[model samples]
Target: MTWKTLIVRVTDSCDGTCYGCLWRKNRISGFTLPVTTINDIVSKMKDFSFDESVILCPNPLYNPKISDIILSLKKVARKIYFFIPVNSLSKVRNKRIMESIDELVIVTTTPEDFKVNEENLKIILSQGFTNIALYVAIGSHTINMDNILSLVNMGKEYGLRIRVGEIPYSTALTLDIKSILAKKGYSVGFTYGMLYGYMASMAFIGNYPVTILAKPLTGECRKLFIDPYGRVSKCPLQTSYLRVDKVTSDILRSLIFSECSIGCRRFELIPKIEISLLTPDGKEIPSEVLSLLEVISHVNSLRAACSIMGFSPSTCVEKIRKVEKEVGIKLLISKKGGKEKGATVLTDEARRILEMYREIRDMVSESLYSEKGIMRFKLG
Candidate 1:
């Protein structure tokens, strides 16, 4: 399977001295990744056909040539995410970095940080950076639900997106966060890894999306990190790395997977297929319509189906009506309430359509999982 993320430490330097710092703990001196080294890495990535998203981690703002570094990395990256501390916002002095990066990921350790950097946050938001977020490092301190809620409320107020990470140490905190968000009318989608006990959950407060992740104990590393010394490794926390010194393609591929075992089945990659149906006249039926029909088939109420699917009742009905008008067939049957409540159900034709759609979807999935089809997802 192909790796989906590439992380580069543009500089191993930072002005702030936070707790649990590996840099200070190891006494590693401040160093900036040179523009020449960055160009070399980008060329190697291009040669390897690495087109995934790149994340400049630790504190890229401390690097003097950050603007040039971002421009060089952008040549091979699908998108560039710059990670910096809340105090490093002052180093963002020009529009060069602002105009290039796809997202500005700000690292904050506590809830009071939102108030401390209120003016700076306003300035950055006003300067044309549309996709910015706050990464709360739960590993840095003993955080509770109140702290998380406070951050969420401030995020809503400032129109900022938020994510909480490093939560594997506390199962109670994870449950509490999900429970509180659910009780407050926020819809949460949660899942945990069976083998490693990794917890990940997602929800949205207004327009901003909230994410929480508990790092897996052991799994297939889908991320490649390039440290300041020009060495590469899949895991970010790995201490040693393999150096790529203008090597051949075969040698480089070997070096990339040298740490990972052969035929390791910790995590498996699967193909994703989008199922779409078209009418005879060429009108496309959205996948949402199929999902709504399926939900209504079980719930027997349009309102209940919409609630489960995160859609407004009126919006869902309008979508179904459009499809029905185009296909020239009624998809749903509605009954008005008398002494009992109103009810809804799919028509016979709708059931047939659902079945046909499922058959087609399964066939497509089976085809894509074949040996020939699996080649498309392999990394070069």
Candidate 2:
């Protein structure tokens, strides 16, 4: 799948002492990304299609070039999302920059923050900024239900989008909020798919939708994160895996199988495809063999493909030979060389088989989606 969203960390300098802030824990020496770096990242992103760009910073107002950052990203993305602390709304000096923002994500924590956020929302609305969302981060401790309901009512009054995100390793608070909202006849259902890494449930309040995001889930990465230093990763919360220098299709394809580390280790939700192909001798072709074959076709090196697939050379050869014997066809043609350099290519029969498998796989995937294009996820 093409990358649907690109998250760019424009800055890491933050004044707020929000509990368990990821920026504070993983911030680098370079506080903000320069305009030149932003342009470079945007150019690289054009190679792989992305619908929207999210401007990330613990507090975007702290960046000196915040205006330029937003303007630069506006040229590429169809929509630009800016994250700003709710209390810092008054700090926005450049009204023109706000025009470039397609959505304003106002981060709030407690009831007190929401109180301030309500006033802040009014201020922005007066300035003609209507595309706004209130992002509420809830912790594991017991919360005041009255205040939470008050926040909900306020959202309903203003017709604003509300997103309640579960802080890492917490579930009960969001579940309680979901239960409360569901009981009130609010339209609540699971979101089409994961956002960032969080699996969310949506609740509609009048015309606006309130999304409650559960803790981060693993597998099937759909988001690409670019840090302040122009390094790339599959998720914002993980370590940078590659740089943005001369990014090719190979680099992007490699991320498809890249594993990202999750902060919460308790639960995992990964969507996968199980394929069963029986040969004449009652043998089945392993999925890993197909993946290895595909990687070899792309990189043109057996050793490099083996390293990427985490397979020993001898083991990969044995698997390939087994599949070849089962299918009665030559799957791979290899020319031996150094440890990491060699010519490896797929045979005509192998390409046909891989193409057929991929077509069936994509067909099955599309079958799992609704007519509106939302994935109809099932659990067993």
lDDT of each: 0.60, 0.61
Q: Could you give candidate 2's per-residue lDDT for residues 209-313 as a string of tens digits?
A: 466665434444456677766677776666556777757656754653465455342232233345546666777877667656655665676765554333458
Counted clashes in each candidate structure: 0, 0
Candidate 1, position 183, lDDT: 47
Steric clash pairs (candidate 2):
none
lDDT of 2 at 366: 49
For each candidate, give its TM-score against the true structure.
0.60, 0.59
Model 1 spans with C-alpha error above 4 angstroms: 1-3, 17-28, 47-51, 140-143, 167-186, 190-201, 204-208, 214-220, 246-248, 251-380
Best by lDDT: 2
Question: What tens-digit string does per-residue lDDT give for candidate 1 at 251-308?
Answer: 5455544443322223434332356688777987777687567657756778756644
Q: What TM-score would candidate 1 get against the native?
A: 0.60
Please give the RMSD of candidate 1 to the true structure.
Answer: 11.9
Q: Please, what's the RMSD in Å of model 2?
A: 17.7
